[model samples]
Structure formats: structure tokens, C-alpha cells
Target: MIYSFKILQRYQLSKVILVVLLLIVLVVGAVPGYITGKWSWKNTPRITNFKDLRQIREEGLTISDLPTISHQKIRIADHNWLLQKVKQDNQSVILLLLTPNGPKDKPQVEWMDINGFNRWKTDSHQRVKFTVKIAGNGNGTTDSEKQSSNIEARFFRGWTNQQTYAVMQWYAWPGGGSPETGDWFWKDRSAMISKKRVPWVAVNILLPVEPLADIDPYLPQVKSIGEKIQASLMKEAFK
Candidate 1:
């Protein structure tokens, strides 16, 4: 009888352990989905209107705090405003969130503005090229110096022409030298170009460090960021 009782007690303990394990799994699985669903339910702002967005920014609420409309976020502003396509005047903005192809722990949100919402509108592309000098040594001398010079650059978006005349350029400058601004080309989709739009602002971004010259060692991460930025811009445009 004693042996039988012991075996029964052991079976009970085993059953308890299984129950506990099952409970843990259920909790663990449910928590993330619940949180994600909650997050998805919030409203995010669409870029089609900026006066409303300006109000949201001035109101000082983060995007996550807003209510949702049809599962789309109504307040789309991100923390990296300068890097996240914050607009001024009539210029469109672009933000490159993360680049390294590896898992990004940071939240990624892509936004764009079309038409020179608040930027200098130029008719000719030739007049738009300007120098952008980075104030550091690019000699690749010391490891620290090299790292300092190795800028993982990201840009906010603006345009000189309408969305049809958007330009994308990359440049670099040594500490005390003239800025070596690279070629600037229209980045607008051909459809916009065919539409004859003026004061066009198409927000685009070269994700952090992807467009910088001499950037083989900084691949994967740098390239990934650039690709993400580009993808984000395209996604926003489509939306």
C-alpha cells in the first residue's frame, strides 16, 4: 500500500509540473500577441495632411499614444524627427530608422512628404547642387580617428521641385577641404514626372551610411539601413 501511495503521489507531482509548464507557455505566447494587437489598434496620421500633423507634434504626444482608425496609426511621427522625415514649410521629409540587416531592436517607422512643402523650389537641377562638407579627417589613420570619420549618415527629406523633380545626392568632405558633393539626380517616379507637377516634394532617404563612398567594410549594417530607409519611403509613398 505504501509503495502504491508513493507512485500515486509521484504521478500527481508529474501532472502538476505539466500543468505549470502549460500555463507558462500559454502566458508567454498570449502576452506578445496581446501587446501587438493593442499597438496595432492605435490610429496613425497619414502624410496627405500636415496641418493636422503639426497639431499632433505641437500637442507633444508620441505616435503610440494616439487612437487607431481602421488598424492604421493616425499619429505617425517617430522619435528621430531630424532623421525621421520631420517637415518644415512645404518640403516633404524622410527618415531612415535602422540599417544593419541584422535584427533591429529599435522601432522602425517610415514616412514621406511630397512636393516642396517648405523648401526652396528650383526649376533647374543645375542650380540645386551644393557642397556638404563633413568636418573630420578621412585619412583612416588611427582606429579611433577612422571610426570618427566613418559617419553612418542619415538625411531628412526635402525637395527643390515638385515630387517629379526630387533629387538624391551623396557627398563627403574632409576636415578642412571643400565638400565633394556627388551627383544629384531626380528620384521621382516616372509617373510623377509625366504628370507635370511643380513645387513637387518627394521624401526619400538614403538609410544611414549606405550611400557614403568607400563603404565596403560597413556593408550589411550600412546597406541594410539604407535599404530599410528606401523601403520605408516607398512604402509610405504607396500608402
Candidate 2:
């Protein structure tokens, strides 16, 4: 019985050592990742097949390249962007596509920067703030699945260059997108942990509001165009 007790004790001790070793390995692996994610910015994966503006088309809409002079007035060397005009029915909008051009580029923050806003002369008053929902067709029937199928984009109204405009923006991922930068940060961290690369694009849609016009009347149109632009990005640009 004494011998058996000794054997049992040895077994338990070995098991404990094994568990401790595993925990040490996990910590060692995770510590570097945590530090890297917290302090360093990862370069966006290169997109080899970024589609041309003329090559992208929605069912009932028309797209054409716009002169970049107005949009490029305050260009940053590390930021890359494209401007295009999209027309649907009798309505039209300017689509601004911003993406990371270097390791340090943060397109989301760049556009949201107060200094950049001031340079553009964007008014401080926001007429409205809302979200635009983009739903994807998924086979899952669960609530979580349904929720994942839907992406909410950020929208607001601001006056830039003395023109009131309806603005919508989001960061486009492979399957969907989110307006919150935190979502992208978490996703990129996960990708880093898995040794994978995920590409993203920042999209902005601008629709001019006529003088004395109510923006509420144009929300639907803006949402529709935003959805179309996102869908096109997912299908063509980010695929």
C-alpha cells in the first residue's frame, strides 16, 4: 500500500509538472503577441487585384472616375485614396475610397481626425447620426448567425466646404464590415495570433444636400448607395 501511494503521488506530481509547462509555453507565446498588438501597427496585406473604378458596376447604377484634384488637396504621403462618382436613377454621390498605403497608415483615424476636419473646413454641428444596415445571405438559422450576417455602418450629416452633405462610412472586411475601429483592431489581433493576414478598405460616401433641404428625406437613398458600394467592394475589390 505504501508503494502504491508513492506511485500515485509520483503520477500526480508528473501531471502537475506537465500542466505547469504547458501554461509557461502559452504565456511565453501570448506575451509577445500582446505586446506587439498593443504597440506596433501591422502593414495591410497588399491587394494584387484592386479593381479599376470603371470595372466595378452594380445592377442599376453607373460608376465613373472623378477628378482627384479636390479630394487630393490635402493628401498625405502615407495614405492612398480614390474618388469616384456613382449614379443611380436620377441621384448621384461621390464615393471616397481610402486604404492603408504603408505600415503606419490608419485611414479610419485619419478621416476622423479633428485637424483633418478643420483643414477641410467641415462644420462642427452634426445634423443627424444614424446607422445603415447591410444584411448578407447566410444559411445559418441561429440568432447569432443572423446578427453576424448584418453589418451596421456609421452615418452622419456634416457641412464641408459650405455644403451640407449626408456622409456614410465603414471599414470593409472580407465577409462584412463595421463602423467601429475597435472591431477591426480585435480582428487584426486575432489574425496576427493565427499568423494570417486580413485586408480591409475604408469607404466614405458623400451626398450633397440642397439648400434648405431636409436630410431625413434622403436617408434611404444614401443607405441604398452605401450598401451598393460596400457590396461592390466585397465582391470586386476585397475578394
Candidate 3:
């Protein structure tokens, strides 16, 4: 009877030691992740029905109301893009909207680089490059929204086979705008730490410029139109 009692006590002590070891391991493993926010949970809401250009508009910009020259879906680098035109300030502007079509669709900024331009036969030759700043509404209820509201877009002057245009392009997200895919990667990593998910769309805007004219003269109009488009996308599609 005494031997049986000793055995039972040993079993109980072993169980208690095992439980303590497990708890220690759990704390050691979880504390660093928690401190670094590597284990943070973020909500990524899918943006839907964004293909309708009519639904996307800024206060002073008129979209798709003018005569449509070309409205079609063109494939580039294994991804499909919506190529359409909008009238801004009575000038026809070409807008290229690229969105993720499915779970497997991963969009990259390199898709629109020189080789991609060659594929489209645009014969694009990039010239002056600059950045446009879009002011935030300052009414964002969250930090991410506020930061994203005030973002910068990249613009450039480029020559196509037909004409010269002031082109502005960026990968826009609910959290902000990235001029390059690499910029988006770092922003996304930081956002993950902040427990935020940023889904993005590639936006390309082209405004016609007269040949032999200085591009500096056309920058104001490009900035105005670019700001409106970014703001409109944030207001409409992101919601």
C-alpha cells in the first residue's frame, strides 16, 4: 500500500512538471511575435465591382461621357487590363485600370515596363519624370487611412508612336500609393505590423501633349487630374 501511494505521488509530480514546461515554452515562443506584431491579425476586404468606370468619378472630372474611341480588355504579361478613355477638362485622357481578377492574379509594376510597352507596340520613350502629391482629407478615422489619403504619385513625359503624353502611374491602395512594386512590398510589410491589409490597383493615366512644347507647362493640368483620379478611386472603389 505504501509503495502504491509513492508511485501515485510521483505521477502527480511529473504531470505538474510537464504542464509547467509547456507553459514556459508557450510564453517563450509567443512573446517575441506578440511584441513584434508578427502574429497580428489583419482584415483584408475584397474590392468588388470596380470594372465599372462610370461609378468612379471625381467632382470636376467627367468620365465615359464623351464619345468612346476604344473600350476593351487587353491582356499584358498574363494579366488582363481594362483600357478605357475619359474626358477631363474637355481633353480626352487614356486610363488603364489593372485589378486582380482572381486569387491567383498577382499584379506587378514591371508588367508595364519597357518590354511590356513593346508588347503593346506603344513605342514609349520616357522623358521627364516627376512626382505629384495628393493631399489627404485629414478626416481618416484610422492612422492607415490618414497616411494613405496623403500620398505621392509618379508622373513622366513619354513619347508613343502617335503622340507625346504626360503619363502618371502608380499602384494605389487603400493605405496609400506606391510608384513601384518594391515600394509596395515594404509598405505592405509595415502595414502587416500595424495589423492592416492593403489591396492595390495599378493606375495609368495619359494626357496628350503637343509635340515640341515644353512638358513643364502641362504639369499643372497633369497634377490636378492625377489628384482627382486618386481621390476618386479612394472614395469610390475602396469603400
Each prediction's TM-score versus the true structure: 0.21, 0.58, 0.59
The sequence of per-residue lDDT tens digits that candidate 1 reaches over residues 1-239 is 99999999999999999999766755654455466674211221122423332332233222221221211112223332222443323333233221111111111222222222234332322212222222124555554543111222332322333332223322211111111212111211111223211111122333222222233343343333333333222222211
- lDDT, model 3: 0.59
TM-score of 3: 0.59
Judging by lDDT against the true structure, name the best candidate.
3
Tens digits of per-residue lDDT, candidate 2, 70-187, equal: 3331244344455556555655667666655444343357456423643443432332233323334566555543322245676666665567777777777666677777777666
In candidate 2 the C-alpha lDDT for residue 70 amounts to 31
Name the weakest run of 10 consecutive residues (lDDT summed) in model 1. 175-184
Off by over 4 Å in 2: 1-78, 103-108, 113-149
Instruction: Go through the candidates in order and give each one's C-alpha lDDT.
Output: 0.29, 0.56, 0.59
Cα RMSD to native, each candidate? 21.7, 12.2, 15.5
Q: Assess the local accuracy of residue 1 in candidate 3 as a C-alpha lDDT between 0 and 100.
A: 100
lDDT of 3 by residue, 1-239 (tens): 99999999999999999999766755664566778785432233333444432343221223323444556676666666667776765788887777665433434654455335633323233332333233456654554435345445665666646677777677777646766677666565555444444566777877888863456677777766666666666655664
